[model samples]
Target chain A: MKMIAAQALVKALEHEEVTTVFGYPGAANAPIYDALSKSTIKHILTRHEQGAAHAASGYARVTRKVGVCMATSGPGATNLITGIATAYMDSIPLIAITGQVSSEMIGRDVFQEVDITGATAPFCKHNYLIKSAKDIPKVIREAFHIASTGRPGPVLIDVPIDLQLEEIDFQYSKGPDIRGYKPTYKGHALQIKKIVEAIAESARPVICAGGGVITSNATAELTELVEGLGIPVATTLMGIGAIPVPHPLCLGMLGSHGVRAANLAVAKSDLLIVIGARAGDRATGQTDKFARQAKIVHIDIDPAEIGKNLGTNIPVVGDAKIILQQLLNYVDEHYKEKHYKTQWISTITQWKNAKPTNNIKEDGNNEQYVNPKYALSVLSEVTKGETIVVTEVGQNQIWAANYYQTVYPGGFLTSGGLGTMGYGLPAAIGAKVGSPEKTVIAIAGDGSFQMSMQELGTMKQWDIHIKIILFNNYRLGMVRELQKMKYQMNYFAVTLEGSPDFVKLASAYDIPGEKITNNSKVKEALDRALSYQGPYLLEFIVDPEESTL
Target chain B: MAKHTLSVLVENHAGVLSRVAGLFSRRGFNIDSLAVGVTEDPNVSRMTIVVDGDDYTVEQVTKQLNKLIDVIKIRQLNPSDSVARELALIKVTANSSTRPEIIQIVDIFRAKIVDVSKNTLTIEMTGVADKIAAFEEMLKQFGIKEMVRTGMIAIERGNQVIKIGSSEESE
Candidate 1:
């Protein structure tokens, strides 16, 4: 049947089983909005295009599907850049649609026209500029495929205005057929053999799993592999959900903010088997010194990542699930009752036992201000395992990473790669939208919260029941900490002298707000925020001297 | 580390070469050498990259190259029976100082002087990577002031394109 390009977009999205989209309508994208009105897809009108992209990110993270966001050309599309880059850095699957000028007016710099495809090329996984209506169906399908497939990331489709109005026969296709876009999911037999050989020969081996495992839904496979081999597992921040925190073999998160034992374990391991992680700088501090003692067996779907950061002695290029399955097969073939050396396990166990202990004095009578770590411990104990936690960059993010115990998969969301501030509030709103049944809380520092605090209106407008817990240290706490540690305490721009009262700021948005000066009020504020039916904010005047991480 | 041949198709535009070469240097992936030339597509140029890495790394580099917007396609050519060559132009002092010695060395290497002035002789030579490196080293002894080389480019000796999904045929 002949249909408009905009109609084809809706049809292709329907084929992808996308039920909802988040976006704001503009003149350039009016055709798309009009077509969406006729389709079954639900479009959530966002206060800002950035919010739309971030909300889509949250939705995608929860559903493990490509979250769709739309905007018009020019500023409408540019607004989504930050959110798109956020998803790109985090490896979240997102499909961003934008309207463009007519093909005839493209090079003439028509009103509301921007070269969005070119603008987003460096950040996007892939992008397409639709010149003809006939290509809309194929382009949309390819966008979804590229965004959600191996090494998932944001993909953009810039639809020209004329094409959107043009009619074409648009039968929705279910797959992509570009000759150059095949992604490998199965491990090569020889590479798998080499990995198995390396594992068998190593006396001390540890597995470093990343978010790809969760993206591939290979948690069970990873758990089985590690448990079967009796090897310890350390996860990147994005890899939090790959293994249950309760599992004895799981070594929480590994990085600068990682568990002390996990970091030390990586430092001492004889063999490091990295799966689905690029070994990003944050995860591997001082790259030259990272895992210096270990021979690395890097497994990933993207082959370029093998030697991009650190050289891999054995590289397996395939999907995490398929590679794990192959390794399991190899292990079964070379079955041995005692694969792990007992001494290695015992040594690691001893290190784990000596891990840092959290102690909070019950009296709380000290004249000095509360430690952020202690506050985090208290929050962790109160929030327990049921609440979803979102953190801003800097001290608050580090504190949450170190203290918050995420008992559930996909429970923790933060800007790990980009480390963007103001990510907490909008992302938390998205997370709440994605999982409305859960209690979502965002932990933000004074500086970071102010970056995207305008999103509080979004939460209010959407009636999202997310708790905003602002650690009001009256400064950019992370930068301050860095100054003290590295810059010899010469605080320059890190100080926030005349900050607005967060309680008043939260009230400006007509959201219920509170300020807690005493540690005794933390639990009560937390309880009130959690119990509040709508959005709520609690500003805690944390001591500036306290180290959050 | 094993040598691998990569064929990359990129947009024929300025600064693309710098960006592409810069990526290699930053990554520290030792490119033994590379060759580039215009392909059948007038707008697209092909680069044959010879690097030392395993199969997985080679495939990865190719994928990354393809990811570049300027780059259209990339394929790994088989090492066996592939012709690899490089071209180098050397400017040497050709006055009474070292004119005879430079000519003798250039003649021995079967090189040609593409440009000649009263005081300078510019010799152009094309050969494999080792030969180019050797020629440059030999010319350094004769007070060589400047040298330029087009990196190595290669193609299979037979009529074989670096077709996709030809894993069985590669070996």
Candidate 2:
């Protein structure tokens, strides 16, 4: 049937079963907006293009589908750059559709014309510039396929406004037939066998899980593997919810700022099974010293990630879900006997038990400021470990990563790879929108909160119920801490002295909120926010001297 | 670091070159030289990238290239089992007195004089990089003017081949 390219694109979205799209409209994309107005897919208008992209990422994480975001050309497309980079760093599956100047004006530097495909090519998994209206369905199909496949990341499709307004005989395309793109899903049988044998031989075996575990939806398989073999699991920050944080065998996050026991366990391990993780520098300090005694068995879908950061003795290239399942089958056949890791587990337990206590006093806390760690622990307790906690970057992120116990898999979200400060609030909105029944919270520091605080208006407009916990430390806490450690406390631009009153700011959006200072009020304030059926903000006055550790 | 030549088969697309080049620069992998051209199949293009790195770097280079959606296959040619060649155009300062000597040197290197001016002789040479470098050295005494080279391209010896859906034994 002959129809405008914009109509066909919306139809293609429906074909892909896309229910919602986060976007900001502009003249360049007006035709697309007009077509979308008649479609069933819900459209969310974010305050900014970057917010739309981040919200899409959050939605993708929660829904386990390709998140879709849209923007016009020029500055609208440029605004999505940071969000796209953030998604790329974390391997989030996102499809960013952008409008362009008319095809005739493409290279003429016309109004609202920017080479978005070129701008985002370095980061996105793949991108396309649609030249023909007939290719919309094909490009859309390929974009979705590329975005959600092995080592999933963002993909871009830049459609010119002229093409959007053109009529075409559109026939819906079949499955992706890109000859150059085939992802290996099943691991090599011999490699899987080798991993099982290595696990059997080693006395001190540890499994380090990364974000890939959650991405592949293999948390249940991972949890079973851990329990079936009695192997302790240490997670990267991105792998926070791979296994329940409170599980007995779960070692809290491991790395530079990771828990002490996890680091010690990794140091002493004889065999390390690294799965679904790139093991970036943030997760592995001084590569040569990382897991020095361990023979690393790396399993990742992307062959490039196998030994890019750390040396691998046994490398299995395939999907994590399939490979973990393969390992589980082998375990069922050969590892029915009792685990030989009892002594090793005991040693790790000893190390975990002997870990030092926090420096904060256990008695009546200072009346002027609430301890961030203590407040987070209380937040975890109040929520019964069931809430979906998304954190902004810096001290608040680290505290939440360390203290919050995620009882369910896929419950923690953050900008792990990019460390984007303004991610939490928008991501919380996405998560809440995707899973309305689940309690969603955005934990932010005073500095990171203001980075995308305009998203508050988005929440009020959409009526998204997200309980925001703002940690008002009045400083860029993470950078300030770094200066304290490495620069002799020569602080310069790290302070946020002119920050607005967050509680009053929320009230401006008609979102009820209150500010609390004493440690005694943390639970009450958190409870009040959680029980409220609408968007609520609770601000805590955190000590500026508080350290991430 | 040892230098390794990787022949990658990719889809014939406009931005594929940029994708491959961008990946190298962003990942901090140094590319010594790169030569690309249409293959036997017009729809597929081949990129011969010479990367200077150790075993770890070579492995990373190959795997990262394979990650690009445009790339169909990658084959790292073994020096002993591959025929490598590079084409160079050298403009030598040729006066009537030095013309005979320059022609003799070019003849010895099995090169051809593609273009000639009163003051210069532009000689074309196609051989391995070492051979081209040696030929350039032979003409150095005659005062070479300018030179340009199409970086190295290679093919496997005998029936051994790199193609779509072929076994990765070559890699």
Candidate 3:
């Protein structure tokens, strides 16, 4: 009838139906690890705490469950900060547990003691510092609840070792009675009716979807609403797979370097319906100029994001899935046979035909090296738009966003908000672990790949099937491109010199890899890597001067 | 930008104050004055916060605070429709010569001498910020020794009430 807090935490994790966890063990976390060793949960030991965090996020993004990660106190907890911020910015539901010093030594600055709760307060949706063993059950339950609910975000828990050592008469328990924390799910009926009426009345209407659509898993509802009204859909980077990429009415991504057609359609549309999007600077170039002709309707769960950057004619604060479902229902009941004009569709199609957005040609001395765009196109062709494509930030992410086709929601995972360079490699590992049947790939730049390449060891250890499509341009190409465009072609410190021999590095980890150059070699190398049974790497010799255009 | 007065109801729990303060400080929103005390329900506490910001900033602050689990409700108290007051204690340098003068001043201001010493007379008063400011301005001529003031606390003028309703379920 009685147990230690460490054992109780494991029980809580089991009760929540968590099958996998990513973490590292240390002195402060010895008790928890001891109990974890006896539990049935599969624990992934990552090389760095950051990898543990990103891997957890990747797993969460794919499974839509609260991904759990752990680390010891002080340095280990500090290392998880970037990963926590990345997940927070992306609205991923995660449970990050960190070991703490004994309660008596918390403020005394003893060995491995740090105020992790204070450090993570601003980013995490909620955090707790466990002072008593009896509070562990309720804390874990509330942690999971707060993590996966309305607008999902990361939550943190810091358990002092002394508390974990305390034995109490603990029984398996339910969650806390939190009366003040209620989230509005279903939107107002009047607002739904108004939105439906607006869609019905508009001639040139466009639907813009964001990461919130994927988080809410409302891709089906969004398709029904937009396609029913014959409205073309333009997505942000995070909303890449909100609907099938090849759908006829899709304008693809719209923003700073978006598809020309998507941007043009949004600029010309009369009514713009923004669903689960914050309209960031990258997504909305020149806020004053963005969708100037459109009367926008913004729907999101977070009230702060409603009018953050742009003004909205109608702001609906509720879950995207619930609101989209209501809108679809209203449309079915009131105007089931309603048809919108095809004039706007014809105009967008003309733009799409004038220049295929995915077309990338080998230009400027391309005989020896692969064009980055060409490599991505081969990736798109080989994967058939059906694989999980996790991309690191910079030119690589932009290229993948430009060319890759997504077949399903949550198909593309990228660090859009925080834009951490080391995100892709570890996240792909997590994604693969979360779904073993699916093919997972980390499309990364050379500079970004090395940032978290330690995860390559984790992959070897776990025997996961993840293909790494390394675009080795031998430099940080995105920053170089920015400098070329803005600073009179002056480049300094952005180039990657003294970098490790990547193929040799992978081989050392027993991960077989092939070095690729020339546009013709890309398809064959990717095919070979993708066909490999276990983890494999393909390093592409991309032209250093190639920009993302 | 203009000054705003908001009354926040929060669950009486540890870390609630730190969470609220952390949010405001992290976002660079300056708090002019803050006062907290338990409400009629021992389970909940009331906080009056004054900040200077524009409409958009206030909306952002309100939305962010609402995201916290411990926060129950937030209502901006309108000056014209609310009765607000603050309590302050002031100690003035006093002697036999100025003792009679200070007593006359306290009588006129409706203040009471809570403590008296050889070189000082400590007076306590409860009133709106403007009234307290006027009293201090006049008493400063006699050379004040020390002073402490509680931030503003408010209630609606009449039958209009702001209630913190606890929902029974989440989602």
Candidate 4:
């Protein structure tokens, strides 16, 4: 049976069980749109290609499925780069399909022609440029497999206009068997036993969980291991919500911006079992000083990451979920003798209790601006640590990460690696779409919120009921503080002086919004926004001189 | 710091070269020399990469190269157990007065004069990288006009081989 590549593409998506796609259309992908219209898949027309990409990322994170996004050639594909890079950095599984000019016109520099595959090669996990319609089904299958497996990241498929119009014999292929693309899922038994012995020998053992816990859905296994072993857990910025913050064993995030106690725990440990984290500079501070006293056991799916940043004494290269489960089993079976970490826990507890971690507390008497931390604490309190908090980078992100206190697995989403601004609003829309039962809130600083403010139209048009919490500091708060700390307070190009009244801007989209000026009204304002049935925006006036800590 | 040679087996495709080269440049790993050619298996390609790095850097380079989807396998070729060769073409400025001396030097190196004009002689030599460099250095006194080199290529001696599914011998 013969079918157009566009029709076969839609069929391929159906075979993969893709229920929704975030996209922006043009002449290049008009045939795909036409085919998509006849299928059961839901199409979300984002205001910009960037929004579509981010929204797909959000959807992927919440659904734990490969997010799909599409855009036309040139500028449309270029616009998806930041979001692609953002997904790549965080290891979100995504498939970005872009339309190119006709096959012959690709190299001729015709209208709307860009080498998107080459442009995204540095960032994307893999990419393909389709030359034949017959290869669509196999390529799509491979793209999905590659995007979702190993260290999940974005995969790009560039289809030319002529290929989409070409008729080919259609047959959906089986799962990919690329010889060179095998991902080791089962860990070595000897390495697992070694980790157990190291755990049993240490007086001060700490587990550093990274984004891999969430990516591999190993949160349950991790929580079990942490609880069973009575070992303290410190998470990277990307590792938030891997173990609930309320858990006594949880020491919160560990990094430059991480909690002081978590950092101390990692530094003082005799043995550190690092799972699924790269231990990047931000997380490790200075690599030599990071966990200097500890014998590190690094467990990760990617072999390259095991000893990339920090030296590893015992390296287990496999999926985190499997390895953690193996550790759990080994502990349950033969590890009868338990090492006491009472002094270690008490020491960490004392450090956590010490008030200097958050030295800049709300003075309570300030009437002009809201304490952003205090406001987020209220949001956490009112929501009962139940909301999916997607935060834009800057002061707002750090505040949310510290204060939100996510209780469930995968409850927090942010651009931890890339630290992309304007990520929250669109991501919140995607999360809400993916998980309709949960309340999703996008927390953004004033400067970051306006980066993708046009996404308000996407929410309004799709009726996505995501709450937007914009912290109005009237300046690029994070950069201003950076200048104050490092550049001798020479503030230039950091102020949002010409920014619009965000509340009024939301009103123009007919979304109800409120503006609060002080900490006293934070809970009431958040409660109001969360209680509203439709989309809502709540703006809080934060102090211009507010410190992140 | 130290020089190491890695023989990588990759799927034969247009993008595989870029993917391997891009990984090196992106990761800040410096490649001193690289040579790629089709293997006995038509679908497989072999790449010999000579890099300057310490043990840590070599480990990282091998691991990073293995990460690319096109790369099938990698083996760090030990100098004692492997045979390495490089081919270089030297275009030396040759006049009637200098021709005999250059030819004698070429004869000693067992190099062939592949192309010759009245003004220059292009000598093709196949040997170890150091030997080729030494030959080039000897000819530099004669005012060589131009040169090209196919970096380096190596294979295991004594029946040991580098091929797909032969990853146990890799670093």
Candidate 5:
């Protein structure tokens, strides 16, 4: 059957089980929108192209599926850059579709014509500019395949407007088999055996988990491995949800902003079994000092990351979920009778007691001034079951990292590597779209929220009732804090000039919002906000002098 | 810092070079020389990258190159056992009096006079990067007008072929 190329794109999405897409339409992408309108898939019309890309990334990060987003030519495609780069830095699987000028006009620099695939080439995992209408089906399939496999990142497809209008003989079942792109899922048996021997010999073994564990959906395997061996698990910021923070063997996030206990766990260990984590600078502090005492065994799908940051004694390159299972099997077969170290557990317990993960002491005795940490702690408590907490970068993000107890996999979503501001709101919107059954919250700061406050228009447009929790400190608190510590208190442009009344801002969107003044009223306000369904916003007036540790 | 030459086999694609270059930049390693060419297999491209660093840099660059989806294989060319060549074109500002001296330098280096203007002589030479640099340096005495260097390319001295299947040897 002959069908419009744009319609074939939509059918391809349907074949991939893409139930939702976040995008903004323009003249170049009008044909795609025309086709989208006829499909059962929900199309979210975001206020900005950036929001659409970010929302798609958020959905991908949460669901482990290739999230799809679309945009028009030129500025629209340029706007998607930051979001695409953000996803790329964090290794989130995303498919970004951008409309181009007519094929004849692409290089002519016609109005709204930009080589998006070329522009995004440096950052994206792969990119393509569709040359013919006949290639649409296979190209779309290839885009999805490349986006979701082999340590996933964003893949872009640039469709010229003329190509969208062109008709093609439809064959929905046909897909491209990428011969060169085979991702290794199984670990070498020799490597697994070596790890088992290393584990048996190790008196103080620490499991360092990163986002790859979560990316591979290996949370259960990771938890079981740690539990069975009676080993303490320390997580990178991206690996926050791999194990419950409250668990005894679980050390909280490690590195600069990470708790001392987790950092100490890595530093003191005789054997560091690093799984899925890239061992970034922030996570390692000083590279030489990071797990120097340990025989580091790095496991990741990307072989490049194995010895990138720290020296690896044994490198296992494969899918984390499968490798973890294989290692678990090896451990069970050989070390079933072996007993885990008691002294190691006791030492970890001492460290845990020394530096507790959740001690939010209310320093502000005043009824009006709210402590950000205390506010976040209470908010964490009031929100009951199956809540996905997404946070903007900086102090609010760190505070959330410290206070929020992630009990489930994919429960916590934040921009880890890029540390991009204005990520939370759009990401929360995407997360909510992906998992409509769960309660999603976007935790933002006074500075970060305004960066993409325009996204409130998207929330209002879709009637997306995502709980917006803004920690209003009236300043770029993290920057100010950094200046005070690093630059001898020479404060410059960190303060927010004439802060917007977020309550009124939400009101402008016709959503119920409130400003919390007192720490005592945080719970009541959060309770009220969480109860009223459709996009309630709450602003916590946090102490400006106070900063996240 | 030790200088190492790496032979990287990659899928022939537009963005593969950019990704390889980007990875080096992100890691703060500068490429001393880079030469890319299509292999016998049209789908494969051979990249001869000369990087400057210690053992760590070679390890980092090799491992990172392998990780890229486009990169198929990588081999470090041992300078003693490999044939490396670089091409350089030099345009010298030569007059009737100075032409003989420039020609003498070219003849000594086995270089070719590719182009000539009334006042300029363009000489082309192929050798190891060091020899090309020396040839260019000698030509500079006659006031060189313009110059270009094609980074370095290498092949093993023996019968071993650098193909798609060669990467399995690393494993």
Candidate 6:
């Protein structure tokens, strides 16, 4: 059958099971928009191109699939750069399609002509400029495949206006046939055996989980391994939901904002088994001092990630599930009657017991405003494991990371690498869409939420059920905290003055909102917001003096 | 530490080179040299990078590279049997005082002067690592001021093509 390149793009996305796309219409990409209108795919018209890209990122992060975004050439395409880079940095899967000037005018510096392919080359996993209509289907399919597989990132396909307008015979193939894009999934047997050997020989071992564990859906296998070996498991911020928070062997989060016990365990362990984690700087805290006492064993699907940071005595390159399963089998065969160190477990238990308490001091006369940390603790207690919590960047993110208890995999979503503000609401909308059965909550700081407060319209438009808990300290709380710690508390531009009433703003978007100042009213307000939520916002005027971590 | 070859697939765009190169520079990863070009897919560009570090450090560098938004795929190529090539255009002073000596040096190195003006001559050379280093070192004496290198482009020896099909089939 004969088809146009723009039509092929839509067909390719359908094959990839992409149902919805976020984008803005433009002159350069009107042909694509025209083609899309005839297809079954739903196109969400975003107010801005940046919103479209970020919305796509949110969708991809929640669905664990390739999120699609579209924009026009020149300025429209350039606007998607930040969102594309955000997804790139965090390893989120996204496919961005941009409209380009005609092939004839590509290098002539004609009107609306920018070398978009060259502009986006470094930030995307792979990108293509469709010079021919015949290349459209293949390029689109490959772009999705490359973006969603292996380490998973954003890919771009720039379709020229002429190509989009040109018609060609289109055939949707079963799969791609590129010769250079090989990615290994199965674990190497030798590497698995070596990892088993390391596990068996170690006296004190701890399993460190990262975001990749969740990405690969290896949580169950990881849980089985940890339980069987009595290994204490600690997670990075991105790795929060890899193991159940209530599990006996779980050490919660590790790093600067991680639990004290978890950090202590990581520091003192004799052997560290890192699974699907790159051991990023935030998680390692002074690299030279991190795990100074431990021998590391790193397992990751991306071979490049093995031993990238801390030295790994055993490097197993493959998917986490495959590697863990192999290790489990190897251990079962070789160490059936192996002895575990009872003394080491007792020592860890002792360390756990010695950890400092998080009890909030309640002096009846000392009430000024709500402490953000205390408020988060309260939210944690009330929400427990029922709600999926999304956090904006900065102090609120740190507070959520340190205090929020996620009980299952895929429960917590945040902007980790780029730490983009205003990510909470839109991402929460996407998370809710992905897991419609769950109650989604967005915990955002006043400064951060305002950055993306425009997305409240998206939530309202989609009728998404999200409980937004805005910690309104009227400042960039995290920066202020940093200044307090290192900059002698001389506040700079971090403070906010006469900020818009978030409650009024939410009302303007046709969403219900409430303002809470007293600590005592937080639970009541949260309950009210959670109970009748199409998309509800609760602004908590938090104490500026409170530290998030 | 030994140097290793890393092949990275990235979106073909501007500033991506700087971002990737900047990362290595900032992280203290000694990149021996690097090259980037459009792949079979016009949207994708391949980067051939040579960096010096231990296995762990190299792994770390690749992981960081993977974290980059534009870097879609990265693979560590085997050092043996990989055809590595680099192109350099060096403009040196070629006044009557130094023209003949420079030409003789270029002839000895089998380098071609692609461009020439009154007082300057641009020599283009391509070779393996040692020869390029020697050629550059020799030209330094002729008051070489400007040099542009096409980093390094490489492919594995044999008829095998590192295409999309191989990558997908392996997965």
The DockQ of predicted model 4 stands at: 0.76
- Candidate 6 residue-wise lDDT, A351-455, digit = tens: 766752233433243355776666666776777765788888988898787677778877888877777887777777667767677888999998888777777
Score candidate 1 by DockQ.
0.19
In candidate 3, stretches whose alpha carbon ends up further than 4 angstroms from where it belongs are: A333-339, A359-365, B95-99, B159-161, B166-171
Residue A289, model 2: lDDT of: 93
Judge candidate 2 against the unseen true structure and give its global Cα lDDT, from 0 to 1: 0.90
**Which pairs in model 4 have colliding backbones?**
none
Ranking by lDDT: 2, 4, 3, 5, 1, 6
Model 1 lDDT tens row, A1-549: 888888888888999999878898998889999999999987777778887888888888877778999999999999999989999988999999998888898888779888887677667887778867898888888888888887899998898888899988978767667555667899999988888777778788889988888788898888888777778888898887678665677776888878877888899998999999989988998888999999999999887788878788888888999899988887772453557556677877777777642334334654444455666666767766557788889888887776666666677888878888877887787787778898888989999988877787777676778888888888898888889889999998988878888888888888889887777666777777877888888877778887754
Task: Please write out the lDDT profile of model 2 over residues B59-170, one tens digit for every residue.
Answer: 9888888878899998889999999999999999999999999999889989999999999999999999889989989999999889999999999998888868756564
In candidate 4, which residue ranges exceed 4 Å CA deviation?
A333-337, A356-362, B166-171
Q: What docking class should model 4 receive? A: medium
Number of the candidate with higher lDDT, 3 or 5: 3
- lDDT (10s digit) by residue, model 2, range A497-522: 78898988999999999999998887
Worst 10-residue stretch by lDDT in candidate 5 chain A? A172-181
Model 6: per-residue Cα lDDT over B96-120, one tens digit each: 8789999999999999999889899
Compare candidates 5 and 6 on DockQ and give the better one: 5
Q: Where is the poorest 10-residue window by lDDT in model 3 chain A?
A: A332-341
CA-lDDT, candidates in order: 0.80, 0.90, 0.88, 0.90, 0.87, 0.80
Mind giving the per-residue lDDT tens digits that candidate 4 earns over A442-471? Answer: 999988899899999999898899899999
DockQ of 6: 0.20
* Pairs that clash in candidate 2: none
Which candidate do you rate higher for lDDT, 3 or 4? Answer: 4
Q: Which ten residues in a row have the lowest lDDT in candidate 6 chain B?
A: B162-171
lDDT pick, better of 2 and 6:
2
